[model samples]
Target: MTRFLHDQFAKDYLEELLTPYGTIQSSRPVSSEVREVDLWFSPHPESTLSPDSLGLLARAIQTPAIFEPFRNPATTREIRDCLLKLLEIDAELRRESNRQVSLAPDTSPPHLWILTPTASRTLLGGFGATLDLESWPRGVYFLPPQLRTIIVAIHQLPRTPETLWLRVLGRGRVQTQAIEELEALSPDNPWRANALILLNRLKAHLERNLNPDWEDRQLIMRLSPLFDQQLEAAQLSGLQQGLQQGLQQGLQQGLQQGLQQGLQQGETLVIENLLRFRFGEVDEELAQIIQAILRLPASEFTPLLMQLSREELIERFREE
Candidate 1:
């Protein structure tokens, strides 16, 4: 996959998975120069979802963090660049701490996670990155503590539940296997549907590429069956709920009005589900505009939900 496409996918995927437990700032700008952190996350003091659901990724984000994911192996220059960002953030945090006497004594800089599919021995050696197997898993290499950086070599990670989330960003066989595990997860698993939906979105983006490479073609093929399965399941579930709801309404109101209302309610549920998946929460503003968006045909509204920003969606649907 191309870097641009993969970068967007990584950001969105992590954001979707982590949003409930913390604050997420994708493409967060830093300093006067135009530098952007791919993803910055700070965990909520208390969250509904268990950290165990995300496994190792949860551990990585226990504190404030900066995540920079690479579709391919990271180069030495890229590694250094990530460290520079880390140092910059450290300085910024220290400055703020100095400015505010009330700041906690334990306040510290965010950890930097450089996520790459693979890191060659030579590359790791140059950075003096060493494994801390006692404290972390195999695949996680830490640069000296002063640097406060960790390079997660996705391919090197053990194939287990703990590694599944990060492995979803791996390439070739690794990613394919992760997808299989993700597909096998329980339907009730909170992250399962969201992960699948983001993967489906990634598949759609790959399809739009005019001349896809071999790996991109392979990824698209892998996602096809899963996409069809999710679509069918979602449709069936919606239809069933709508039918039951319509029947209940018919008993109370006129049969025609009840059935129509039931269908509308089902469609509304589907739209709300999509919104929640995309934006993490359906706040008052978003809840108010659901009916407005529902007025459009599926072809139009589906893309609107998938592609538009929150502001764009509100601007287009709120007035009507």
Candidate 2:
């Protein structure tokens, strides 16, 4: 169950970060064996966000690519399964191109990225994976050229901003350290907001399990402060906006009435922000429940916002 949770997080994290630069298809189906590729990404010619901003992760996705992230160290069999998926995709692409005008003589096969927390030297050696450190970074190993596959040993990656995105997919100490780095990035950093939101979602999922392991408990503790900081920030924003609006009304009405109005609006705005962060958007169904949601204290309502599904939340808070 925990493994599936991590897999979902990886897919969500990668899709969020890469969406601006390319087309991202999660759980892409392969024609044979009903195997699914974890992620299939093809870069856009005129992307809104610069690929350079993502550093090494951007480099990996410059071409058509497949991403397979493992929560634990990948065994040999797992690695082969990833390869087979890639080959299946390549064949599928080839057959489709046959029906269209050939653009560049042939379609290039997508590069396969196998990401794992750790990879032993023997494990790499057994697959004949070699490091081209002169061309790439320390932790990345490539199989033979024809294979077009790269195995990233996350634990071996240098602790730097360039590797931060990929490192977030790692486990244990590697993941903990990566998140710490992620938290410290400037608020203006484009990736920071979405990454934190996804991490918070992951935290909520992990917490739902009654018996999380020690590492997950520590992770939950670390993530709690970040959530608080975001909530506080949201409240501050709401208050400022409310006060600005209230002051305009104060000129026509009593100062006390305006201040009371400001407080109410402020709380409402805060709840709206929380809902948006949790569920992407607030539709008419959710809008109907904002007043009901605002009636509860932050401590009481915040968990409901985190743990409940869209339908569940609406059903729980829908106006009578």
Candidate 3:
């Protein structure tokens, strides 16, 4: 199966966000082999990798590479191999750094994280076991709880223009204080306004194409303004179609009812003519029977005519 485009989009999105924090790598071949990693993040040389960074890495690593239907196995295998190599490298790094060099006990190991969107129960089970899980360095860990929680929250939000805006702002560990700083700016803060506009556009693209089914309340509340226009357009289109269909059906039914009534009247006149010719005069009894005959549909009139002879019709129409 071809890998799902959403999976690729998610990977790209996370990579872009995480790049500033650390070195981000994707689909790199492990060693000289055909195997490749989905994503890999290493700490910046100047900064000591914190638990938060490991948390972010974990989120990236755990993000699922959704399988694309009809995708080439070679592609999948290559991706799997790259991920395995990344893990191997992480293990090797830990072994070398922790064992060979005497680093401080408090210093964390270099982390390696993976991303999978729809991880199967079997794959998760495998990770729980020794094949892939054992390669991590001691201090280096996957995405920490906080980062995972944030990612999960973002994932749950509805894929709408508004939700996407909130997501960009909500991602990672930006300070609440910084947000307050932005809020404190006057209406003329061109820089902040421009940033908001760009962010909103990015969110619109993500919502429109990537996660179109997201529906989290938190995300919805934050981004409501951007999505209202699209939502209204869709609703109006649907309403117009419904009204048109309803009007057509009503017109058809009204025409059918009028045609049926006209047919009944014409049939009554035909039955009166047949009675007057056969009996020489129209009587009260014959008139009632003719009325009934006129009301009878054409299909019923044929069967009644087949069963009745001239003599029987005259006798039945004779006054008591």
Candidate 4:
């Protein structure tokens, strides 16, 4: 489940990164016969379409398709076919003359980018091997230089707490370089906030694991707000269930013991009553002793009852 969320996050991150450069379209249908492209990006000005434009297109297309139980195979095939068609379209567009002058024909072909989280070994083999990186029908080329940079950037993105902290601590050595590059392209960037948040989360994890003495009473906070709440509620529910089970078992055991004691006492009272009826009266002291004997094992209590005279028996049978 968490993996699914992470994959979605990656897709969204890629989308956000590309949104600034062009008109971003997602699940866009290329033709009536084909499925929609996962994402399609086009330059606003037709004249601006160049290697850089193709590079941006490549980046947009490289985002992985998330598959689930209900994923449609036909839709997947349609999307693939649509992308192939779009690549051809991009090639034709690039070849057209901007002005009346017929310039030398741009002979480069467009590249098709496919992204998936877990590509099969076979698919990866096809990526750099059988899947031609150079020539295609469209003027767009695969493995554009700018798109390669973006791929490197994606690889360098912090995916875990440890990596986040490492990037922060090595800010001078590592992130500074990337920051400078990004700033050169877009001076006022919003990605800084996201980068900082990732750093903070990494710091928090470090504080919890490494600095036992540094207690910020509020610092033992939940990593995920929703999951943490649910975890706490689940623990409390389990504890309640355990306590109830223990109490029920205790009550059942106590009731069984109590019933046994009551039955023994009742039998002793019957014996005492019989002696009182036969011998006229029972002594108070003897009756108290006989009552105490009710708690003895039935074998012991029965043997003690046989060795008494009528008057002795009457005295032994007396009630308190």
Candidate 5:
């Protein structure tokens, strides 16, 4: 229904990172035109710290704000549209407080943060956006003070862990590099797990829809190894734990679960990843083929999945 999986991923990623420090509402209605803001965040009154993983991204926002993330470079029309939504929101807030816009506190109305992968110099100059290079970074461009808006060009941001949280929302190599850093983080980090799950889903979507974009293809390739590595790591942990507990207890029960099903599930996960990696999400038609794969010996079907075409896979497993 949405244009692509990346749109949803961007919103989910921002919501998760901001959830710890604020109240966030995604796809919130704003104007009479029925425009929906991507994210509306109101910071908590007592909170001072956001998740350390977010780094500089957290430091950028210290007040209530609206965050609109674009998977593509935002155009002038899109910028004006975003401004209109911001105006409507500001009006609504002023009405709710029953206060004059001029009389209320400077931040009574939330600021609009438009985050695009890139913004051209022409667009920035046309809108009269100035970079606060002293306080903020290079990619951040501010409108005149009263307009209350900023454009964040992720690609133009500095390459550092401080910007990695924002960079993960970028395209192609930027996102891949950020994901690599995320993978290097402790496996116990919940943010990494959430991001990886979304990335896996993103890969599946790209695979299923027959994405012609080179960028999507590159992303899928980059994510494939991450999925494989994590699967192997999880399988090893399962095996080691099972063997240790089995040695202390009845060997039969331990072997039955840890050794047998652990390997099966681990292999199954890989097979599932490979299937999705190869063919996309399992449709009702494809699900039957996967069930058949589950029934077969792991070695037999695992190799087959790697080698079979979609049509060949359907013909091979449809009857089973």
Candidate 6:
């Protein structure tokens, strides 16, 4: 169960960072075997965000790519499965460019990225992976250019701000240390906001049990102060804005509007996080439904959004 949650968090973390820079297709299916890639990213010519923001992590991805992140060390078999998915994509891209091949050469197919907490020397040797220590940071092993794959050993990565984001995907002490660094980041940082939101959701999930694991309990304790800080800051900002607007719009009406707006924003956050937890990522139609639900009081929308399955939520929200 912990592994499952970690896998989901890795996907969500990658999506949050990469989606603004290009296209992100999560759980993408390939071949006739029905195998799914965790994340398929294709960079855009006109990206809004620079790849450099991702630090050493971004250096590994400069082309169409497939991301397969594991909660623990990935086995040789799992690595092969990731490669097979890339080959299937290669075949499909070739099929599409059959006519174009006569006029111009085709661009290379997507590369596969195996993200794991650790990769043993034997494991790296088995696949003939090489480390480019000078250009790239430590812990990154690349296969021959033809194979177009890289293995990221998260535990081996440097302990710095540049690598902190990737280290959060690691295990045990590494992850705990990364979380501490994450909180130290400026609250206005977008990654900081996204990470905290996911951590809160993770905390909620673990708390459902009467007694969560010791690690989870410790993590929740670490996250609580950050959560309180954000809440307090948001409330203060809302009050200041409300005071200014109240003078012009009449005190009672302006305060009411400000309070409602604040609550609705909270509702939207909860709804989106719950949807992502259950459905991976929300799509356009679902986003619309979430907006509509936000119009309702929190009591009415909260239970419906949290309790329903994807289909059920869509059906119920769409009908209303």
The TM-score values for the models, in the order shown, are: 0.84, 0.90, 0.31, 0.29, 0.74, 0.75
lDDT of each: 0.84, 0.84, 0.40, 0.37, 0.75, 0.74
CA RMSD of each candidate after superposition: 3.3, 2.7, 27.6, 29.9, 7.6, 5.6
Q: Sorted by TM-score, highest first, which candidate order results?
A: 2, 1, 6, 5, 3, 4
Sorted by lDDT (best first), the order is 1, 2, 5, 6, 3, 4
What is the Cα-based lDDT of residue 86 in candidate 1? 80
Q: After best superposition, candidate 3 residue 142: deviation in angstroms?
A: 7.8
Cα shift from native, residue 287, model 6 (Å) = 12
Error of 6 at 60 (Å): 2.9
lDDT of 5 by residue, 223-289 (tens): 8887667555544554455445444454555655645555555555655566564555656666667
Off by over 4 Å in 3: 1-4, 48-83, 87-111, 118-122, 129-320
What local lDDT does model 4 show for residue 89? Answer: 46
Scored by lDDT, model 2 comes in at: 0.84
Which number leads on TM-score?
2
- For residue 285, give model 3's deviation from the true position in Å: 99
Cα miss at 209, model 6 (Å)?
Answer: 4.9
**Looking at model 6, which ten-residue stretch has the lowest summed lDDT?**
99-108
lDDT of 4 at 34: 60
| lDDT (tens digit, per residue) of candidate 1 on 51-120 | 4789899898788889999998999999998888888777777788889975552245788999999999
Model 5: per-residue Cα lDDT at residue 268: 55
Tens-digit per-residue lDDT, 1-320, candidate 2: 87888899999899988888788899988886988989988878675444458878988977878999998799999999999998887788778779777633224578999999999999999999998989788999999998899999999999988899999988888888999999999998888888888888788899989999988899899889988787677666766776777766875788888788877776787778777866668888889999888889877887677656677789898753
The alpha-carbon lDDT assigned to residue 180 of candidate 4 equals 33
Q: Write one digit per residue (lDDT tens) for candidate 4, span 1-320.
A: 32222333333444554455455556655443564455554434333423343243333333322111111112335434544565544445455545326533232222334332222334223333232324322211233342221111122334332223112222222434443343233323344333322323333333445433322222223223422332333334433544454445556778665455545444555445433432335677456666555556644544334323345544554532
- Assess candidate 2 and give its TM-score to the true structure: 0.90
